[model samples]
Target: MHYVESPTSPLYSSISNTSFSSSPSGTFYFDDDEGEKSDEEEEEPDEEEKNQSLEEVDVSVLKTFLNDKLHQLGEKPQMEYPELDLIPRCRFRPSDYILIVHYVINKVLNYPLPCDWVEDAEELYNHNPELIAGSS
Candidate 1:
């Protein structure tokens, strides 16, 4: 019996890289008729499972969530800058967002970036302290 999956489920992620010929270990299978359909079938991938894809979906969700929370926290009548500055600044040449992305990629793929990456980002941040201040 083949497992029916939701098209939108992010858990399985790019099955193109997967070969169904080999049974997956620790897989969650479903019968042809199940209560809730796997994202592969429903076309609605689960939010948590989507994170496993190590695709942009997870990063975007995290970034968006951070942005929303940051903005909400920074809302004040005495605000000096627009609401946008409340979030972490990503203005340095390398940019914090880029670092965040890199970190995410490294963590997801279990790969490590060059040792200089952190130093470079820190240097850039030091050069543009205003961005960090504004974000706060």
Candidate 2:
């Protein structure tokens, strides 16, 4: 199946707006909005905070905002997703799900997370004092 990406797809931005771009290995953005921001852009506000209030709201609020706008414009929101094979998927172990979920929730809430949560979790899980076996 062909995955058509339109510039105006709000869900593409809304759901994609979640922390999907942040990967343990590298950046992976499904939509253009998540792309690299130059220094000038970094100096600017996050896409959500640009025209909206600086108070970080849940990403679900973005969905609601899009819904209100579309309804007022008399347009129905549609999301045409690429096939599972076509989309890039990240595989995480069961042990990894907790950290991943917490991290995503923090992102949705616009809370700050460590630069690399996976690396941090790994360092803790693999090299913590409990596992050091008698070394002070």
Candidate 3:
């Protein structure tokens, strides 16, 4: 089989100016134009252009998409962990879910997490005592 990568593919630039061919023996060979460089290899974006591209991404869209995907995973089943009872399970509460989403968004955007972001459920309960009385 012979395969030609499309120029529009994200991986095209990395494997450009090359073609792949497989023989009946299942051996693959890469035919590369060693003397020539693809157009993509010649052009590089400046720092300002990279920043502009990042700025163009809509954070709200990313949040919504991530939330939807998380929800699709379904609620986690409750289980006892006697040895690890001191740990807080963030998957049990709606607010915890939001916190998780925000944490992920902040990570993706290279933003620092809030000082109050708690990983331990016990610590979270101590910070927001009222949460302990509420049922999941």
Candidate 4:
């Protein structure tokens, strides 16, 4: 019997230039279900697999690279800035968040920045969810 995949099945990612989607292995298949219904009988792709075609990246490797880079910059950078405690603390790296808040956002707002970098907080948290999740 041919391999068939149904929606709602957990799709373990395949390797080789892995993609969030659009890779050669972007293909997702279901277990062979002879009784499975047709697409006409099924829900749309949005019905939910939660994570389909999740690219297989080694998080440990990514974490190691980040750690080494941070080491190069030294503990001074981390120590000088404040922890972003006003925000409830998601998975974002303290060092990375400080770099952006202390440098990038500070410059963007044209200095005279108050103790709070509140203006850019939402933007940072929203955009970096994936990276934060991966790092965690």
Candidate 5:
């Protein structure tokens, strides 16, 4: 990601936008190239790495267990839920059903959500002890 100083903007005179500010204070402008891919080339993996599956072994086990549980529950698991009928379906994109499947698997495994939702829940109860007791 390259930052080119616009000569027209007078705010930064000596600081060409390319020069990341060494200033140690209040307001400094820095260009953010959030999505720019760098020019560095990535090395291609060998045949062994290329043959590896996207689904991890643990994830595969979880999927199998979930499928078995769903069978026992007498509800056939579907790739897409009935709710997704409202949206234009695509072959590549996962529908609401896929999200639900993931949610259930995580729940059954007692796995916390990626961004620490369990901590947030605990914090919520801590902050509002009365609300927690009352809701239950």
Candidate 6:
């Protein structure tokens, strides 16, 4: 036995003929009247505009935020690893270590390091012979 749907069936009557249409490519799409912007039509900020916005941000605000984050990091309890104690004692203080990290990060980012930081980093390097061997 085979079941056939007639044009007069309730299912056929409920669906509007205008709801879908076929394109020249033989692909069917819903006919929508609401205007919507496509991805291509949307405007994005240009490099100049992005740079201007970045320039507008206060340096002090960024500094304060960095200081707060660093303070929080310092407040965290230091974890002790017994195996790491086999190495010679590091001469760098916590602040000096932070300075060294900042120096390295600045170098990696290709940003200019401040004169004082360079001097401090040199001093720390001179004081620590172990770092030289590890670096090599």
Q: Which residue ranges in model 2 land beyond 4 Å of their true spot?
A: 8-57, 76-136
Kindly report which residue pairs in candidate 4 clash with one another.
Answer: 5-30
Which model scores highest in TM-score? Answer: 3
lDDT of 6 by residue, 1-136 (tens): 2223358843334333325333333333454543555668645656654444333444444344345444544544234434444445554333423542465335544568765323235555345555554554
The TM-score between candidate 1 and the true structure equals 0.22
What are the per-residue Cα lDDT tens digits for candidate 2 across 85-106? 4323323322222332455446
How do the residues 6-41 of candidate 1 rate in per-residue lDDT, one tens digit apiece?
576432233323332111222322232434456675
Q: Rate the local accuracy (lDDT) of all candidates.
A: 0.40, 0.42, 0.49, 0.40, 0.43, 0.43
Q: On a 0 to 100 scale, what is the lDDT of residue 41 in model 5?
A: 82
C-alpha lDDT of candidate 6 relative to the true structure: 0.43
Cα lDDT tens digits, model 5, 33-109, are 53467799856656655554423225554465435434544533345434444423234334333544666446544
Candidate 5 residue 108 Cα shift, in angstroms, is 1.7
Better TM-score candidate (3, 6): 3
Per-candidate TM-score against the hidden true structure: 0.22, 0.21, 0.35, 0.22, 0.21, 0.29
Which pairs clash inside model 3?
88-121
Better by TM-score, candidate 6 or 5? 6
Error of 3 at 113 (Å): 2.3
Q: Which portions of model 3 show Cα errors greater than 4 Å?
A: 1-56, 76-96, 116-136
What lDDT score is found at residue 100 in candidate 1?
A: 39
Ranking 3 against 4 by TM-score, winner? 3
**CA error at residue 9 for candidate 2, angstroms:** 7.8
Model 4, runs deviating above 4 Å: 1-54, 77-136
Error of 6 at 19 (Å): 42
TM-score of 6: 0.29
Alpha-carbon RMSD of each model: 15.3, 15.5, 16.1, 19.6, 22.8, 23.8
Which pairs of residues have clashing backbones in candidate 2?
Answer: none
What's the lDDT for residue 53 in model 6? 30
Backbone clashes counted, model 4: 1
Q: Give the TM-score of candidate 4.
A: 0.22
Residue-wise C-alpha lDDT for candidate 3, range 22-51, written one tens digit per residue: 333333345556666667855465565444
